[model samples]
Target: MPQHSPLDLAEGDPFGPHNLPYGVFTTSDEPQRRRVGVRYGAYVLDVHALAEAAGSAHAAVLSAGTLNPLLAAGRAIWSAVRAELVDALTDPARRVTVEPLLVPLADVALHLPFDVADYVDFYASEHHASNVGQIFRPNGDALTPNWKHLPIGYHGRAGTVVVSGTPVVRPAGQRKAPADAAPTFGPSQRLDIEAELGFVVGTPSTLGEPVPLDAFADHVFGVTLLNDWSARDIQAWEYVPLGPFLGKSFATSVSAWVTPLDALAHARTAPPRRDVPLLPYLDDSAAAEPGGFDIRLEVAINGHVVSRPPFSAMYWTAAQQLAHMTVNGASLRTGDLFASGTISGPRPEERGCLLELTWSGRDPVELPTGKRTFLEDGDEVTITAWAPGPDGVRVGLGEVTGKITGR
Candidate 1:
């Protein structure tokens, strides 16, 4: 829990020695070959150098330009590497060897840490789900019949998943207004942002076997901030029998750094009690323990802070989602990502997206420059998260940010 380190880290630095989150980076000087790096203060440690100097096999695995290789290596190697890095950073004698390899974060360009295998997005937050259900289905009950029994999710577009800072082109799709007799195709007018937390799957599982709740830490390598972009007008017309498609598949932004499950030891907390009994397969025993994280997630537009969604407010846990995902005999592959969709708390200010915050575009959110019901062209949306670190410092998941540009 000590905050002491050989590096000149600030007292409340999010990427202090306590948090050696992994990332993929390439500098302006060396842009051809991507290398694995770890965030420490304002510098990124060249993990390839750490691998090479130690002559560890982890070097070749981590040096593959993506975190996928190291992810497949599983928990044992992950623990070993993290421990070794912590020791190296803490050791005064090792400073000389480590200093030469440290690259200032300002000089490097961060890329997506891993190649996505499959993407699944789950609507796990009770507050967010309720808000959405009420707005969309005003005459019907807020929650669906089977909502409490299982974690509801759908497969997302893995091919469209982009790293932070990527420009989100406004999607041109079909939309029919209430008064319109026919649907029209054009650029989306109701573009929005969904603040989310993404779980990165590391180890692959058998095709017929399900990943149990206990295997969450073993299967899921790390967590990252995610922004699931939405086109409301396109979605409202198409989402009748089926769920989100072109309205959502446009672009989903993810943070550059992946904060390992090992670093989030202190952030665990219990979720709210379930009102209904879950099926045996979905009834994870980890629920008796603290299955939720106390991560404070924020959604911002332009330069204004709009909402603060708490991750702990989710109805279902991440472990439960993982268990339900593979319970149908579907296998997990390395780089498989599953996101906790739109984390929202009980308060009005805790809404995760503009849909809820503006009440389905009925109310406009007041800002310094102007009021907004939804994102306008050239609007930049940023999502960031942080939790209590080892000491008084905070451990950040970094930010997933993107700008809306006209097609």
Candidate 2:
């Protein structure tokens, strides 16, 4: 028999009882300073309250103040927290520490789990880059020279990172059509969204210390849905010898729950390879040892949103990204972020973002009702994920959604 979380997890559930991913949450009437909790079924199990109940079991670690403190304690403590919660909250036999913290996932508002110390968005998906490159530079190479040697990445603004539900105010920026023409300042007219996934680093690695591939799992705390809101016109004008500046800075949204790596352990599968041979550090085993996670990711638009299907079309895995991040000895603090840029597959139907789906505004996607071409006012974008199926259903990250309000 397969080992599973104590909870009744179906074959493809990502948050089965075995996985107690952490996050911060607050109610409509609660404070902005959040509390820790785990996702199970459709509820957020408040860990603080649970710790108070499991006094002896959660004693040593719970006294550390916040999940951030304990997260810094290393993987042993992480395992203990997850194990204790599974026994106490998921099982009725050990339900003594389970009351007072049970909040309906639907009722509460979720926040970014931790303060992101740093944000590094990587263009690690080969297919996505190729497709995009072909569209832009068809007569030339599909990928840049440096892309094959290392994980192409850019540092993003941590301050602009917001929780999923937070309203994404349309950003104001500069747009330049031709160098000959002076740039204009105004609210972004070409507002767009990029579907991405990022892993939260748990354990810290000092400056100049390389995080090896095998140990990448221990360094990763969990996964979250990321909607990298983009200003195409702005990004194009400023992003050159220097990458994304004001255009990609305004705001980035992430889902609340930290989907544990343990939950998706069974879903590992290697991504399709390309013709080029990867660099030594960026080898096959580093990307996908036997296989890495294959969680199905989805996206939707508006309240009566039309949802796209799931596909794990990432060119590189989180582990590989983590290893690459610290390859040059860059320190990875507890709240650091690493994003899998725009997950797009070979098929048009599997496209992950509006730029690709709409083919850079050339073809607009027809909603169930009508209208399309990038996002519009009152339009909401939602990103969701799970292992697969409904049998041993694990706690899902739910959905990270934002509406485009008029500037």
Candidate 3:
């Protein structure tokens, strides 16, 4: 709807022309965390300050006790808040409105924008699921029988979900070597990153009351890049009947900003092929309403460039996943979190994670300087996405980068 394109965007810039994601941040100098601002270009704007200054325009939403309360109020308030910020931040003529709060990205210490009450990560990527299953199942069935029918997921440890820039410890677990014959307890040798997008819940639903597929988007506050780091070696031994535990629970990295769908609504595209007809409850009209977006996602290693893949590769749509999630009437809180399973492309090189790209290290990925079996200490991983819309005021998911460090 807004455009400042060609001139404003630098091709792959995530905060350029179209995207405007919001996050909670305070200057590093601040002692406490307060829900403070939105990310635009390379800076954080002070929404809270804007409220104190604008008085009326910001009073409806920004003046809230906190951002979480505004999020719980749902899209109406979110759209209102974002619109106010967009008008104030991008318009040079609106100097008075823009003067209150502005901080360079470097000056801020970002925190989880909202309190995450619970987390559920979905394995809806067909290719990701098929490939991962083959590693363990080998024969009986490639996908779990119900996988095709519903969105498969695992309850994640919400307490460990941290904002981006948080250091993920190199996990310690049991690794079995053929020579040893028995498992050896040690630090994970296969610590890897999974490039994923997570959706945040904006409102709460009543328990035992199913959320209709049509109403799913109304509850989604926004989206962010999520790195569900994996310790494959440890996972192989621990995930027998129950799914991931410690191996997957240590830490998760997410972009500081949560891009609201309203701003990126113009970026929506259609969902990929329907492998199987969805059940009525799982069937959603929104999934068909340009359910996909042309957001181009990319990864970089230690500042070196990696391939950029599109979000369109996902076969199952996020709307379908959200709709299916409520079929059983599981109440989602105002700040619940959900990750789209690792997004991988059909071609081997386009895969999202090192685990898939390197075929579990059997084939190492060739970087600019050389090959990589998995992430090495000192290596940095950055994930970013953006799309163009009317007027070129492109909407983007700012770079979500993290550097690997020794244990």
Candidate 4:
């Protein structure tokens, strides 16, 4: 269990001492240069000031506007800095020094924490994949032949990835009906959201080296909520030869705060059994260690709660994905982000997106705003999550929310 900080955190506070998540922010006082900060309760701790006050070696990096430098410092420095932060907040003697650096979170605007070098979205949830397969290919097997054998993934448009609360313009692409003689170009009719958890690479790797499963936490800094917006109708037309393109590249939203892997130690759970034999590279020998997290995730449309997807139900573990990604000797950068696909659970109520919940447009969900076959203009979708904390407490990953606008 984690010790209490000087700040009096509420019962379910996500930014407690145990979870001093990092982000970049700009206050009205100084909006020119973004500053690095740590979330604690409803306040943001000035990382640079805190580092200087504590006379820590990381002060220079903390003073920067983004987390990339700190991320590039590797695991040793990350551990040292986190330890210093824990002491600064929890130690009674440091109260006077730390108090001055605390700023109310509402007073600052959060920015993207790191510059994204690359982005990869993986289809790792069995229930979500099964549901999508069933809806799209009813005559085919729900589980693809190679799904259980490997983590299916695709490189995404990292440049277009936006922070939470950014408005998403409905994507426009060519769509053709079965009876239509030609494809029509218009704004997407079936805009949807995929609730996912994203992992950030902290340490870069060599070009010809593969990161082992045991070193998962050593390289990954933290996790955040991600919404991979999709266009179903456009995807249906173009995804035959290659996977998602314009249907997926328009915009993806992510929460600003990044909860470190250290904070989620208590939330880890064992993954489900695998159906296929694993290759040596994809082997998960850390069976006793946590392969999944018992994070309870929820999705809402226009303030109405609609789905509760469980992160623990994901078929492929983060460790496995990391190893598989590097098995081909692909190098990693400090800001590489890989996300778990829509994390739907085994039940109807747990579907992650409108596509599965509506059975591929056959069923429409009735929201308080109105019936939604797919998202309509002005409709905002938000995804939030909470995981088990030490001593039965709960820690949260704030949220990733976006509203749809006409293109």
Candidate 5:
């Protein structure tokens, strides 16, 4: 009997030809040499090899070890290369040449797809922000005054961003409780996870120029699953006047695969109803495209599904976030990363973090392993998501997972 071809993926496979998410990988045979590849079914197609073999004009950009070159190559080149890849993989005549370049996913080690230029995380989910407000300030309003008007975000440490599967060391920092007389320093007792989606910037902008809402696709290349690990105890103590610092700086994990923005056309939807009128820069009322995505995210602890956060419920969309991020003339750069903060929904089961789901330790989540209010040492957290694709298919965003280690 003949072996099945990798190209002949089963119908409705998320990572089929329709979803060619890019990544960087290295094989044991050449562990030192990193190559750019695309996920197809359970195999990693060597895109550089394919481009070179086909004598394509965009071969140089794909040949690079990292995706920076290709990311910097603007939207036109990106579309052209993607078209070439689809034609090559789907054309039966080209299968003989393409088959040899395909490598088993298990045989390769995936790495950070690009060198991160900068990282920004946005508190765009109304459900998440409101829950946090109610948890911390039960007597006050659930939503902040500025919450409905603008997309709130903070710059993050870019160096600490890691690819999926990286082990996270439990962060140690100062913490204080109202009952305590003074602050104490030790490993965080309230370690938590924030399930979100991250947008990757491709084309850069001038230093003092602001990227507009319509240019979102021109600047952003793709999306990925992001796990912005948090230490709630430290954050609670430090986040006043100033935003998250040490609590959020320790580490941020992102998926190895980047699902290009073009693949998510079918997933685009209008953002949730807005009660407040937005300023001209942040307003999307006249935008040509629907900014919200219909992606559904799942959070898992030790392999047990916990929450399902809907990205469509987010109040601020990525386009709005980008517009607001650069409203002050902040420039964009290739490989710049911006996350959608914690994605949550109106339902209790849709909360994105343990801080909200467990209500700041007032409640504990029951798991087969044990009860958990906060992540324990050796606990593993994984976030996965998928969006609707053309023809009823699903575009998988892969996953970002990390296991916590004791300090």
Candidate 6:
């Protein structure tokens, strides 16, 4: 029997030719040199090697140690590179040339694909915001007054962002309970995970020019699974007058693979209905393309499936977030990352975070190991997601996982 080609992906494999998510990896033999690669089934394609072998024009950018160079190459170059990759992988004549560069995924070490220029986290889910509001202010309205108008977000520390599987050190900060006389400082008692999707910017905008809603695709390159680790105890104490600080800055984990926007054409869907009218810049009701994605996210702890958050149910779309983010003339950067905050649906099983699922420790979630209100020292949290692809295939977004370790 003829041997199976390394590119011969199994039927319905999430990381098939249709979903060639980009990442950076290094083999053990050359651990110091990081090469840009595309995930193909169970292997990582050495894009730089393939480009050099094929004498492709994109060889220079693909030779970079990180994705930043490719990201700065703009949308046209991105499309050309992706098309070349697909053709090279699918065409049988090139199999001999390509097969040599295919490295088994397990034999390589994945690193942060891009050096994050800036980080912003948005609260775009009505269900998640409402649940959080109800938990903290039971007597007040679930949705805030401005919730329906704009995407609420906060700038985060970019230096702390790590690749998936990196150990998350439990953050230590000051905390004050409702009945406490004074604040205390120590390791956070209520560590939590926020399942989110991060949008990566490829092309940048002018420093003083606001990017309109229609320009989202022109700038955004791809999406990644992001786990926004939160220290609820520290956040609660410090987020009164201002927003999240040390509670959130300690660590944020993202997937190694970044699924490009071009592969998600079939996943676009209309966002949830807006209760209030949006301004011209933020409006997308009459846009040519749907802004929201139909990605389905699953959150698991210690091998136990817990919640499934639907990205389609998010009130605000990524396009809207980009528009709002730049409305005040904030310039975009090649490696800038903006995240879709905890994606939750209306159902109880759709809650995205432990704070919502367990209701601020009032309700403990029962797991095979034991009950968990917040993440424990050794607890490992994993978030994986998939979106619809052409011909009914599933496009997989790489999973972001981190294990909690006491400081």
TM-scores of the candidates are 0.97, 0.89, 0.89, 0.97, 0.99, 0.99
The local distance difference test score of each candidate is 0.90, 0.74, 0.75, 0.90, 0.95, 0.95
Query: After superposition on all CA atoms, what RMSD does each candidate show versus the true structure?
Result: 2.6, 4.3, 3.8, 2.8, 0.7, 0.7
Colliding pairs, model 1: none
lDDT of 2 by residue, 1-407 (tens): 96533344456555557566677777777765567778766677777677776675655554432456666767887777777776776576764346446777777776677778899898877778887888778899988887767778899999998888888888888898756469899888778888888788888998988987788777887788888899888887889989998888888898877776666665667766645787776676544354355666677886443334343567676766888888999898988887888877777776777777887888888886476877777788898876632344544656678888877
Q: Measured by TM-score, how close is model 2 to the native structure?
A: 0.89
Which residue pairs collide in model 6, if any? none
Better of 2 and 6 by lDDT: 6
Off by more than 4 A, model 2: 1-15, 28-33, 57-66, 178-180, 286-288, 303-311, 389-395
Q: Which consecutive 10 residues in model 2 have the weakest lDDT in total?
A: 303-312
Mind giving the per-residue lDDT tens digits that candidate 6 earns over 1-407? 99888989889999988899999999999999999999999999999999999899989989999999999999999999999999999999999999999999999999999999999999999999999999988999998899988999999999999999999999999999999999999999999999999999999999989999999999999999999999999999999788999999999999999999999999999998887998888889899989989999999999899999999999999999999999999999999999999989999899999999999999999999999999999999999999999999999997999999988
TM-score, cand. 6:
0.99
Q: Give candidate 5's error at residue 53 in angstroms.
A: 0.4
Q: On residues 294-355, what C-alpha lDDT tens digit does candidate 3 reach at each position? A: 67778777766555656777776777777778778788888888888788776665677787
Tens digits of per-residue lDDT for model 5 on 1-407?
99999889989999987889999999999999999999999999999999999999999999888999999999999999899999999999999999999999989999999999999999999999999999989999999898998999999999999999999999999999889999999999999999999999999999888999999999999999999999998998998989999999999999999999988989999999989999998889988989999999999999999899999999999999999999889999899999999999999999999999999988999999999999999999999999999999999999999999997
lDDT of 3 at 391: 71
Which candidate order results from sorting by lDDT in descending order?
6, 5, 1, 4, 3, 2
